[model samples]
Target: MATKFKPFDVVIARYLLKPNEVFHLSKPLMYGAKINTGFGSINHDDIIGKPLRSIVFGDKDKKHKYIVTRARLPEYVINVKREAQPIYPVDASLIVQAADINVSYPTLKSVDDTEIYKEIDIFRRRGYKLAKNKRNDIKNDSSSINKKEEIIQEKLLILHGPINSYNGKTITRCSTPPLQFLECGTGHGSLTLQICKSIHASNCYFDGINDLSRGSIIHSLDRNLKHMKIGISTVSGFQKGIYLDDVEFHYEPIGPSNWVNSDIANYYRQLCDTTEFLQGCFLDMPSPEHEFTELSKYLTVDGFIIVFTPSISQIWDCYTFVKDNDLKLTLVSTFELLTGGNGGMREWDVRRVMIRNSEMVGKVVKPRIGVRIVGGGFIGIFRKIP
Candidate 1:
């Protein structure tokens, strides 16, 4: 019979030599008869002692040429610059034991591009409906959505106010300043704008990214920042914005690639950079394997990352990626809060997706729907250490 599908912690225990550190065995180590461990044992002695290179010859071809074929790459030569300290606290005796092995949040089909457009139209109509009633103080006359404060309130409604005053308080508790930070999948720039506003309030400069379109993140950022009484310096593109601060944040595009010229790439070069965060939504989806590697590069020694995704599979993938790469888990939250308003469609889209994917019952509509999602959304957070 096949081995049982063990829990993540158990599976992790087998591969890790220390907390948050995985034992990516050298060819020599893999052949050891008994893999030593604090909890249990493993045996693969048959392959021990022989240099891994000797295997290709078998019994007959001892004289075969050891040609370094380009197709068959040689084992990597990883040079350790110096002895490194433990990235995370490792108590060999303790392990991550939990009743639940994994939690999955499913992706929903309710809010595709057409649905998104429909919702946007509905949201815009709601604003006009509210403005016609002269319901609240019309603050900030910048552009079309000049009454931004009212728009913010309305947009929150669209999100069903899941991110109400209480949710904001909860998220704000752990939302500390980092040397650098990132907000990914920034759609209409709502969360990006909020984060930017908060960072500005702290007099800190952070970097964020959203895919550009005819009227997308850039448009949203432009509209929303205009509402702020403070002077918010907005720039164009990831490469240009790196100088925003010594520390910054990165939000990935819809796809991932090995080519490393993103906002996070530049931030990695800074000496003082310590903390980083990774956020995702519909606009931020990338192949899971690729995203994890992209995220790992930006992390610092004892750095932390916060990831937001709509699917439980994505969350687990992110968690495993972080763990296998020697990252730590600081906090996790499924509950997201948002006050509906204009200039934040991407934020609203995430909420909409989460509501659709999860079984959680959305709060009743308040005042009216400022931010509307056909269903709820999902989010997760993770940390990294060097």
Candidate 2:
């Protein structure tokens, strides 16, 4: 099918002359600007409105040939320049899948099986005669039907991509896309952007303010003012260029104890109480267990709680805390591994715990995939339980 490239749409251009290099650009391309490639210069306007994957020869000389395609989530994530390390696609895929971000199946099968049978039965009862040519056309359209199914699957899987930092030591924890979510310790805002995308895809609203009435809002906290500013700026850049606007950043130092009386904490409490409590809470800090008491207050019944720490000692401490507070939370899964290969290595031990809300048991969270350990860190999966 021919697809028209529209203004402001992101496009990925691959130059045939330089097979290894790829260029990402926005549409409504500047007419006069020359994109200098290894072989020759190509005008931006030459590729605009062209069907994706169509080859556009360079400057009529045809010395440098180029092909344009719609930019996918992975391409956008990889091509977007960042000061802080962004989450790699491999790790990001795992996190998104675990959260059940884009898991969906088509309804065509049900329509074909049940609806078609009902139609056939009705037609037979009515003694209706079907056109022979129409029946032949349906048979001939089987290939097109399969193609439509493929398109549906492609649309469902289009948004699968990474969220943020994966240092082998500091893994960002996640849950099934949450309507009300909290991110403690925003580092560089890589994951924040991913979360924003998730919220946006889910059609949730984020106003960057503590508005309890909003559909979805992410409250990102960081102790370091400088780092918080950087994170904010990073997300702002995304908002301006990539259009991510659902994440709110705060420079409040959140500790298990200190945040209970802070203004932000109070704001969070009001936000939670007004709109059913937080659907997910991701804790990326030195000692996440310290803040569990305060964190649990904001969590909704059957909400997800994910904690990431580099130290095994910290994991053990958090485990013990969950054990002691059996009524409030439970230990779900622990992922630990050490591996090295491909000129890279990783050593990580992380734990995932869930709130014990009693209403969540038997509810299916995404199943945990076995860790291959090609990389260093492993993620633990957990769900809130009664």
In model 1, the number of clashes is: 37
Off by over 4 Å in 1: 1-178, 204-264, 271-289, 323-375
Residue-level lDDT of model 2, residues 303-323, one tens digit each, is 666665554566667766765
Q: Estimated TM-score per prediction?
A: 0.29, 0.56
Candidates' C-alpha lDDT: 0.27, 0.50
The list of candidate 2 runs beyond 4 A from truth reads 1-3, 17-43, 56-61, 100-178, 201-213, 223-243, 253-268, 271-276, 309-314, 324-327, 336-376, 381-386
Cα distance off (Å), candidate 1, residue 46: 87
lDDT of 2: 0.50
Backbone clashes for every candidate come to 37, 3
Give one digit per residue, the lDDT tens place, for model 1 in 1-386: 11222111011121222323433221223333343333334333322332332222111323321211111111111111112211111110011110011212212122233432222211122221111112222233435333544554354234222221111111111122222344333332223333332233232221121011101111111122232211112211112222232222222223333312432232222212232322221123443434555655544444434444445456556555555665443333332222232211111221112267778644321222354221122344444444
In candidate 2, list every pair of residues with a backbone clash. 87-164, 256-291, 358-386
